[model samples]
Target chain A: MNQPIAHASLAPATPFRTAADARRAIRSGAWTGHTVGLAPANVQGNLMILPADLAGDFLRFCQANPKPCPLLGVSEPGSRRLPALGLDLDLATDAPGYRVFEHGELTAEVPDLEAIWRDDFVTFVIGCSFSFEEALLAAGVPLRHVAEGRNVAMYTTAIPTTAAGPFHGPLVVSMRPMKAADAIRAIQITGRLPAVHGAPVHIGDPSLIGIADIAAPDFGDPVAILPDEMPVFWACGVTPQAVAMAAKPALCVTHAPGLMLITDLLNRDLAFV
Target chain B: MNQPIAHASLAPATPFRTAADARRAIRSGAWTGHTVGLAPANVQGNLMILPADLAGDFLRFCQANPKPCPLLGVSEPGSRRLPALGLDLDLATDAPGYRVFEHGELTAEVPDLEAIWRDDFVTFVIGCSFSFEEALLAAGVPLRHVAEGRNVAMYTTAIPTTAAGPFHGPLVVSMRPMKAADAIRAIQITGRLPAVHGAPVHIGDPSLIGIADIAAPDFGDPVAILPDEMPVFWACGVTPQAVAMAAKPALCVTHAPGLMLITDLLNRDLAFV
Candidate 1:
């Protein structure tokens, strides 16, 4: 298991300041760790690559469940470039790492997708919570998990996602415990960035959403919740991975958890206002 | 004491399709009740008329405490018209009723400001919760106060308003009980309308903000809270009134509670997005 990267290590001692710089470093195998705080001003996205046959249904699923799977960009069959997100973005190798799955079962983790690129592949770039986390931190709402060098605690909720074809599963949520004041501000700040899991799905209680234990999360590390803090949950981008796995597509690929596709699009561009 | 006006009576037999028509009715003394639910599509504002000598301090106060006192429009001293809010708006008589205060004590409740209009008077139109409430209702979030035909329960909070000169006091908040789901939605919906107490100041608990009892409120009527409901509070426009009274200006004027100045600006115009 990969140990959680310290928040300080998110900004590596490298000359990669722009998204293009970061992508080049990522493509050249210069950086293989999580891209949490790297390229801090630009938008980082969750990536999912599926065969052309399953792309249409996945698009519909994202449309039906936008809060979890906000589609930032979608590529045509066999395409690797997404000029809208970044002038030089190459989906096949832009992410820090890629997870290859065959029949929904993870087969290998590779630094680049060039080794097993498929002509029928279609890439979907979904908005991630990183953009809003940047917004929250900029607004002075301290994130406990990020501060403590732990992954955001994630849980499978009782709430069901709106199904589209074979893509369906219980909604997955990422949790961050915060003071009520910070939580209120977080809601307002994140609410403006709907492309990145806007606002929160649930707040205050855990069992209310079917979580049996606050200390144990279905995914990620659980951070300490102080007596004054409330556990706020946002619909996770991981939902698509869960749904895609459940669908059992012939071939599917995704960025390894916390390893995202850095884009030239500034976080401000995603803000609705 | 005047009985709470039925939501039906808010719309009279007169044709008030436009804000100008509604103002004309109020000016002609044809409408003399609460303005809630009337001219539903237009923005209704809380009215505050202060002498020129205090206008600067009041404006600073509003600037310092924006959430509780969102200043929508302010008129030149002695000007009865605010062309920005409405082409035909007359600050002197557009509202249904006015409260005259002398040294911060209410001396009279009159239908029009005509009898006491002064050359030194400066009119201020503050954004009211009614605009965001309209947005909330339009978004299908049911307001318990509206449904129960009572005023939104308001309370005084331990949160202090940033002071500008003599204007300083505890922040006033209006509470609406909603399930956690609706509360989250309300935050997103209202967060877009910052001109009118955007988003909520507090959620979940009342005592956390210094309210000793959840059953009793300092202002407005309390409504029922179901087992699933959590009380959400927004910065109330009434904060200005409380602050102004505490300051004890020589003479001040405000629209009677629930009576407001209907403006031509549509509620949609207030949405940040």
Candidate 2:
């Protein structure tokens, strides 16, 4: 999961203390790296931009599978600003990096979407697990992937997501191995934040969910599952991207994996309480 | 787990619709049976009345172990009424049945505490799992024991409770067998009711918590566990009674298992939201 050392020079000299600061840095081209540890207190969202023609069905798909695609805010067609997320935030440029998909195939990776921005584009900000991860870490529950500096292991499960139009596929889940006690605490802590993939989707035996091997994952780097720990699975934000890709949309733009759009909303604000 | 058929003759022809009605029925000589399923929409509490001298330490014990001994309301010494629980409820007679314990040994079973009420007694109303069970059932999560017409299986665990003065012992947990999906839903539903036992303390394996057999329980009748289900355990309110018994208070009083004090508070009122 180690990043290329050559890219270290583009990393920010100091970590961002707020979502606004992080977005400013990304917009100014000072930070072009993954947003994992940056703006730790604010919500970082999964970005998905599609044409207005496909927006209705995709919105229904999100409503059908809220655990994986909890819609935080949706932008009006062709609008760059999502005032609810940030007053001056530009959906096309706020994310550090963006993946351009042409007919469901990754055609290009761009630092900013200015050249490809379209008038009929609609932006959908989906809540990511990072919000609840911050909550769990704040409560002293250790996340193995975060501690080891690796991407959380994600898998494709046999569990079918509720379909809407062409958006229908198997659910994707992120795994975090923890002791039984921590797993229970994680459930309680994350259960409070329904916007961010609330609670665990499955626990204990991974085979029940159709994962053939515990050591290998379909997405992200695999981390160690200690002898005493159980792998706890949460519905992943990757589900929307995967399902959208399977449908072969003519044009779809998403934040690259590990690179998210930092929003001004605080993580605590996302908690249902 | 069946109660004597003779007791059915003493039960009300129709179940009480509210806590006030149930308490009134118990106060009168019309109801002398277990309070399960009676006043189902309200909070049912485990009653614990101890001497005034021991009240301080007992309160601390409950505060330290809120999961197992969630303190709902504490009465002023010698006070028969708890206005917060119910405006006209009498601690001495609201419960359907009570067990008189002298020096930690069960001496006699009585319908009410009027004959043995003490001037220096302090009634401690502890939250019970029945509140969360109601929430689970309302959410369409089926509870095996409730469906089978049996007691929820309970086991004494290797997990120990934090000590406060003389009160200290192993944590007792109530087990509910559920399929993976229902167990996940149950955790989220029950997690919202922290005033009750809250989310599960442990899940998946029983032996890990020192239980030798899943079929045989330390207390309450063992209900059938389906082959596809896992036993999910929650911190049982029985922990307080067990800890108090180990302390051997000179005179202690408690509601007999399954016979709880119905409180005026609605189950929805206890949700953390």
Candidate 3:
């Protein structure tokens, strides 16, 4: 989970309300710290802005591996808003932070996208694990990361993604410790929300996916694991960014890892059935 | 898909009609065969009838594992009708065949229960995997078992069911061969219908659940497997019948495997969302 900034004077009543208001505040540069726990119930997503040239591959990538890169919204080329996600969404500056890349190289960290707003930029909103995390929380599934106030332990697995042009790399997974019964029920509950990483990709043995160490993670912080619990892993949204970076695009922009775009779309809207 | 059992006497258009129509045909000995792939899209279920003394334990066993043995309808003690499944559902004579077990032993394979319908018999209609299979077929997921026109491969796993009196045994799983793409879609599609062994229990590696061989199943014939596919397993309805037979009630009876009770209820009615 992303650590959100505490703005005592501006915090909203509830987590959901706080998210909507927080995004609005971030759009205006009032609060640009982080959007992790701010709007807890609402669907928060990772952003990938690229020219129309690269979007086709990214779209294919998201469509191919929907579990990790579940697409919530895809803006028209040169458009600044994705009406499906939020009626008043401004893709360029709605997120709390942005990382600009030129030729896949890190260039600048901007609070807002006022300077590099490109007419050719197309914004793609991919579903993150946070939406399902919220769903799990609502269903009374104990989340070790949230309980311990630590980011989920994310590992780069050897399982390769379905190739979509230049977007192809090893799949990324986030680990969560859970009892067998809770794991089964969590699969049933999260299985309802296809847009939120859906059900876990792999369960039981971590070695099956090529994770050498359970205690160490490629990204995020490691939480505690009890004796009776199995570490469940879900495909992550960073997969596309990692794939895109490896692809070496001429120009790429994305939200900072922890600073996701909070959308007005209710998490419940993600359930297919 | 298995060849539809089209009776010449009945309207050829209605694949499998009312239980009365089926039983009337069966009683006259017009049609005596497997009921599966007979009723097309209608709900086909497992049938169980035990003496009144052992009804409570059997009911508890069904309740314990709703996935494998979801109780669609249960009859009053000494009654042969299940009003919930069908208005004129006569459990004593509806199914084409019945397996009679006495003292945990197979005593006879009969055409009807009229001669042996005990006054204290309690009939229970348990949900079969047929409902979800219909949904999967409707969703355009190519079923390998159905394509090969064979019974779904079922295996007994090391995973044990919650003990309810004397009825307890390892969980039984039905296998379906599917590629990653179809497997994911199958997960989402089947997850909607919880009454039909919703989703899958173990996917990818079969040995992880203690099944030494995927091809050689304990029950049901094996189907063809593709190189790009994984063997997706589901909690099979046979788990209850097998366990009940193992427990060896004083007088126990069940529908012949593959020949189930056809109910009037639509498969979609069982969907949670």
lDDT of candidate 3 vs native? 0.77
Better of 1 and 3 by TM-score: 1
* Order of quality (lDDT): 2, 1, 3
Give model 2 RMSD, 1 decimal: 4.1
DockQ of the candidate models in sequence: 0.66, 0.61, 0.15
Give a tens-digit lDDT track for model 3, residues B1-273. 011111111111344466456656655657777766566557777888998888898899888888788888889999987787777777888788888888778778898999998889988888877778878888888887676666678888988999888889989888888765566567767767777777688776677688998878887776777766667788988788778878877788888766678887778778852
lDDT of each residue in A89-123, candidate 2, tens digit only: 99999998998888888888899999999999999
State the lDDT of candidate 1 residue by residue for A153-249, as single tens digits. 8888999999988999999899999888898889878877889998898988788889999899888887898877889999988788888988888
Clashing pairs in model 2, backbone N/Cα/C closer than 3 A? none
Error of 2 at A180 (Å): 2.2
Where model 1 places Cα greater than 4 Å from the true spot, the runs are A1-15, B1-15
Query: What digit string (tens of lDDT, one per residue) describes model 1 on residues B163-247?
Result: 9888899998988888778888899888878899998999976888899987888878767888877889999988888898888
Judged by DockQ, which candidate is best? 1
2 or 3: which has the higher TM-score?
2
lDDT of 1: 0.84
Evaluated with TM-score, which candidate comes out highest? 2
Off by over 4 Å in 2: A1-14, B1-14
